[model samples]
Target: MDSTALDLGEDNSLLLVDDDEAFLRRLAKAMEKRGFAVETAGSVAAGQAIATGRPPAYAVVDLRLEDGNGLDVVETLRARRPESRIVVLTGYGAIATAVAAVKIGATDYLAKPADATDVTNALLARTDTLPPPPENPMSADRVRWEHIQRVYELCDRNVSETARRLSMHRRTLQRILAKRSPR
Candidate 1:
């Protein structure tokens, strides 16, 4: 444990949903320091359960989990607490998914490597004000690479299955998957 758990008064509660345990602990500690009483869940099921038991005023949800999509949790949370502020974080970001997240009640979408500061700002942002557009949006190649990587993971890293689903030659898919992601 990073630190002794503190009593989180209901008014200051927050829920963090992510599969990365280490990142969860670190973000929980950081959020605690920033005055949120943090509750964490490592899967969509756990997150939905937490929200059902007691919907927090705020949430930070990852886009993917070991068990299911984070969007499900977001939908549950929104249904449970319509006023809650929710931000979606993803290591694999796509414009389509980002738009879907907003439509599903997420207040903001952040591509990962987002830190506690970024999450905090997003969660606390005024709903009436629009956030500034990204100064450097992802290039088409980067987006395609990210999409392929996501689908590859979804296919359990099976090259043949992924290639089939992507309608690409197996060797071509393997070659692209093998290369480092573009900046």
Candidate 2:
């Protein structure tokens, strides 16, 4: 089935909040083409501002932002529009965070590299069943690399801090970060 073909009607307004400027722009354009009135924000504060002014019917929020957690924006969106369908998108997806997001009112939690079709399905699904899992899931090494990268980012790209948090030697962390992500 073409998930993107699901028409949310003329009143289908959406807010997309992410720190990646290029990704945000592309996703906004894609969503607009798919029949949503799209508004974009690059931070939690900015998202909150737009949402407060006019709450969207749907929202796609990133888990990490320059200013704050996307959950903060999700909370505000839910407060403003109790019926809003919110989806939390994250590069650093974790079971704990996903559970927290759902508990706080998000309709779905998706990992990064999610396309417009995935977002639409997440926003409009009537059932709890998630989209089919990826055919080829990441290998253990690849997942470890991704997690290390996420931690590095969260630590403001500080090698020492990331190493300390991960309980690894600084040089080892540096070497891992320098290597290309595992396939």
The TM-scores, one per candidate, come to 0.73, 0.83
Consecutive 10-residue window with the lowest summed lDDT within model 2: 1-10
Over 148-180, each residue of candidate 1 has an lDDT whose tens digit, in order, gives 988899899999999999999999998998899
- How does each model score on lDDT? 0.90, 0.90
lDDT of 1 at 42: 98
Clashing pairs in 1: none
What does candidate 2's lDDT look like per residue over 76-105, in tens digits?
A: 999999999999999978899999999999
Clashes of each: 0, 0
Quote the positional error of residue 47 for candidate 2 in Å: 1.4
Point out where model 1 deviates above 4 Å.
Answer: 1-10, 91-100, 134-140
Best-performing candidate as measured by TM-score: 2
In model 2, how large is the Cα lDDT of residue 118? Answer: 81
